[model samples]
Each structure stands twice: as C-alpha cells, then as structure tokens.
Target: MTTIELTAEEMAFAGKIGFYRDYENKQRSNIADYDTKRFNLTSLQAHRLGVMCEVAVGKFLGLDMLKQPPEVWTGFVVSEHYEFNKGPDILNRFEVRRANVRTSPIPLRKKDLEYSAQVVQVYVPYTQTADGISVPTQCELLGWSDSVEDWPKAETPSWSKNGQARVVHNKRPMSDLEVMV
Candidate 1:
C-alpha cells in the first residue's frame, strides 16, 4: 500500500477549497436535485474528501493536480460531459474513491464510472472527527480498478452509515498502478 502524506497547509487548503466550492454551489443553486453518492457525509465533507483524495492521488503518482482549484459548474446541470475534474486524469484517466482500509470496496456508481477510465481507492489512516469531517495527513493508496465498468457489483453492506452500496470489487493492487503509465 503506497501512502501519500499531506502537509498541514495542504490539508487546510483542501478544507478551505471544499467549503468554498460547496458554498458557491449552494449560492448558485447548483446543488443537485438527485445525489446518488454512497456515503452519508454532508456535501461539505464529501467535497473536502474528494479534493483531498485527488490531490493525494496525484502525489502518489508523482503528478500534479491543477494549480488552481476548479471553477464551479457554470450551470446547474452537471451532466456526464460537463462534470468537473474527477481525479489526476493520467492519459488513461482516474477517479479517486474513499473507502475503509479494512473493508470497503471501491465506490463506483454507474454515472460516475462513465467519465472515469479507472477507479483509485483511497483510505484515510486517522479516525474521522465527530463533526463528520476527516482530512487526512496520510492517505493509503489502496489500489485501483481499470475496466471497472464491467466489474461485478451488488448492493453490499459496509461500515458507512448509509449501509449497502453498489460497488466494484477486485481492483488491481497499487503495485499494478505504478507501472500503468
């Protein structure tokens, strides 16, 4: 398991970006009408994790995330073609998903998989805060899944409060990912 550790400043910056984006999305009413995300986190928490994980994935692969954070969706409709950056986006493409280090499958919803060529599963090493946000100084690069669109999936129970989620199994180990370039 490859580990990418963020500095205090990186974590704080990620938190700020996540909160700011959520605030902007709400201000513009870009918050979706239907969110099929598997986790129980508030939009703010989710966004924080999303941005932080993406940044970590980039570091794990020795790539660079966008120097500037992404702009808010111009319109309320964030369709497959119009969705924001999913992850590090190596030529093969990737979307980072958070899961428990012990037992969590990659969270690959149908719509989310469409835009991603691969799924990168990440796990934060520390316990989440009571306030429901967990910004990790170190993230475990558990592994990844290529051709995940065809992976077997069923509603499976998890440590998440939302319980069962339809997800991909048998992701390749992180060792396989490093040579993927």
Candidate 2:
C-alpha cells in the first residue's frame, strides 16, 4: 500500500469550504420559494466532499493532479470513458468515502465491477465548531481494504438514507497503514 503525509493547513484549504459558504449565503437570500433552496444541496455537498478527499489523497500520494482529468471531466482512460471510473481518482485509483458506517460498502455494479478500482479509502475530517472556529487537525485515513471482492455485491440491494443510496456492510477496522508525512 502507498501512503502520503499532509499538513493540517493543506487539508484545510482543499475543497468545499468556500462552496459551502456560498451555499449558506444563498440559503439566506430573499428569493422566491426559499424553502426549496435545499433541493439537491446535500448531494452537491457529498459530491464536493468526495472531490476534496480525492484531492487530499492524490496529493498525499505525490501524484500530479494537473495531469488527472477532473472528477467529472469526460475523456478516455484505459480504453474506457474517464467517467466510467467511480470513486477516488488517485494513485491506482480508489473509491473515496467519508467516515460513516452506512457508507462502508463499496457500490460496484456487475458491469461496473470491471471498471471499478481495488481500493476503498475512508477519510474522517476534523470538526468545525459552531463558534466559526475550526481546530486544525489532520484528516484520518480511517481504513482501507484492497479486496475487490469486498466491494458491495451487485445482486445485493442497497439502502437509502437522507435521499442518498448506500450499500451497507460491516467493515473490519482499518489495517495498519504507514503514512510517510
């Protein structure tokens, strides 16, 4: 397994802080039907969070982000469309997830299995206090499993929570990961 180190400041500056701020501003704006403003906001937040994790993970691995296609960029990769690659787009490619028990199962459909990555990395972010203050803390690499078979089974149905679909499973604690920071 490959590991990389990241300082607190670097992690803090990567992804979604500003986007969320803008979102909050919109929430308070005097617009028609403001109650529906939260529409699709959660999914957007999740997507942004995933991108943030990918940025950190890619940086930690010492890979050049400029050379990689944006997470949603369309193009060819390994004989297939780049969008075909799900999860984290790092080193050997991985599916990134925030630390949550319900999200442990990797969703690899039968057809998607061929295009799926072998690693599943979960990142637990440091908390931001309500006082508008956040203690600088390193995002934890909760755990990873290299077993492709461990990904969610295609035939097994997934569950939904907060309007998001998730494959649930009991994952073993993160293995001994060696990070060279």
lDDT of 1: 0.59
Query: Tell me, what's the RMSD of every candidate?
Result: 5.9, 8.7
Of the candidates shown, which would achieve the greatest TM-score relative to the real structure?
1
List lDDT for all candidates, in order.
0.59, 0.42
Candidate 2, residue 68: Cα displacement in angstroms equals 4.4
Scored by lDDT, the top model is: 1
Cα lDDT tens digits, model 1, 1-181, are 7788887777876677677666655745432322535455677876677667767886676654545323321111223324353433333366667774536666554544455457788877655677765455887888787634444554443533343235656667887774453
Q: What would the TM-scores of all predictions be?
A: 0.65, 0.47
> After superposition, which runs of candidate 1 have C-alpha atoms over 4 Å from their true positions?
27-40, 66-92, 128-134, 152-166, 178-181
Q: Candidate 2: lDDT over CA atoms? A: 0.42
Query: How far off is residue 44 in model 2, in Å?
Result: 6.6
Question: How far is 168's C-alpha from truth in model 2 (Å)?
Answer: 7.2
User: Taking the tens digit of each residue's C-alpha lDDT, what string does model 2 give over 1-181?
Assistant: 2334445544444444435434544545433322233422344344344445555555655554435654532112222444444443453345454543334454333322444443445554434355533323344454554344554432354332232223435444444433332
Show where candidate 2 strays beyond 4 Å: 1-9, 16-48, 66-88, 101-112, 131-137, 152-181
